[model samples]
Target: MDSANSKITVLYEAPQPEEYLQLRAQTGLSLKSLDGAKIGLANSIFAVILRQEDKLIGMGRIIGDGGCFYQVVDIAVDPAQQGQGLGKLIMNEITTYLDIHAPKGAYISLLADVPADQLYKQFGFDYTQPKSLGMYRLIAL
Candidate 1:
């Protein structure tokens, strides 16, 4: 995670809507409509984006009410950029943000996709399964 290239630039901000969509699409994260991307980026409690060679290479976000609850979302790195600890780079930025901002007893949560869940665990995240289950229903619009 900390092993990312020293020269890579990390910005504590969400990327533009079009750039966000492209990075997600490239990284196999779910695609979002232009309007949805715009709104989501605007609403991020905190965000981090990494760029190299003037291209968006990775990003992550935190979203939720300012207090009590927060969810980690949209952690992605371009497929071509995967396996280089870029995801960890993104997570590192996110946890740093949370540590500075989230209050005591704050509930930080994330829907960790398989394999990636391993990455989350390194940052002190764990599964709630066999005791609690994670579930979701996509909104239709």
Candidate 2:
């Protein structure tokens, strides 16, 4: 978990569209179109990237309407580089940004998947079930 001990580097910016798609595929996240990747990445409210020797190893981003609503998305780590605490490193940077930039009334949220939900919970995220539920349906262009 020590960047100083390895070639790993953490950057406070989103990766290029191609890298985004590659990482998502490597991590088994849903594939996103190139156009969607470019537009979505450019619109990130906040993003953190992990790199090793100039190669992207992990990434996470926050996108929203830029006022009161925010959602964390695109959290992915390269399969070859998993088990090194990179995911936590990305979340640390993200939570730091939110703590400073998010307004007092802002409600930041994320849709966690299975075991990954455990990681998000460490950053103060909680499930809103019974009282409310998360729903989604994808559309194609």
Candidate 3:
């Protein structure tokens, strides 16, 4: 997509509480009220939401325990809007936020899904190694 046709808005302001439902549904990122509340409480949660007028076209977020470790999460753009680089726009915003806010020695990480790995690599993310690994437990709903 041409830059002229697409406009990306980066908002440092808090995520709208109500939008969580739509975000969760669209991104397939499991979000509960507790998770929402946790995001609300964090001192370092940065989010970027892309909108075409009133419709939300894309969004990305960074969440973590705060000072030492941070994780990129919920990076999604509508499938219809894919290939337009909206996901890259969202990542750029998140990268800026981390660059400005995260302190030295901070460990930033993300779990990429398939082709998205190529995108995240541009931002300096890498796979875990022999020293450690990415592990997660399924949360049965």
TM-score, each model?
A: 0.91, 0.93, 0.78
Q: Which residue pairs in candidate 3 collide?
A: none
Q: Mark the regions of model 1 whose C-alpha exceeds 4 Å error after superposition.
A: 1-6
Give the higher-TM-score candidate: 2 or 3.
2
> Which pairs clash in the backbone of model 1?
none
Local accuracy of candidate 2 as per-residue lDDT tens digits, 5-123? 47787888999999999989888888889999999999999888988888998999999987899899988898877777888888988889899889899999999999999999999
Worst 10-residue stretch by lDDT in candidate 1? Answer: 1-10
Which regions of candidate 3 fall more than 4 Å away from where they truly are?
1-8, 13-18, 27-44
Best by the lDDT measure: 2
Over the stretch 1-141, how does candidate 3's per-residue lDDT look in tens digits?
234456555555444656655666776666567565455535447767777655666777787876799998778787777887888888988998899989999999998888899999998888887888889996654
Tell how far residue 85 is off in model 2, in angstroms.
1.0
* Model 2 spans > 4 angstroms off: 1-5
Q: In terms of lDDT, which candidate is stronger, 1 or 2?
A: 2
Give the alpha carbon lDDT tens digit for every residue of 1-141 in model 1: 233454567888999999999988887777678999899999999999888866788899999997999999999988877888888888988998899899999999999889899999999999888999998887653
RMSD per prediction, one decimal? 2.4, 1.7, 3.1
lDDT values, one for every candidate:
0.88, 0.89, 0.74
By lDDT rank, best first, the candidates go 2, 1, 3
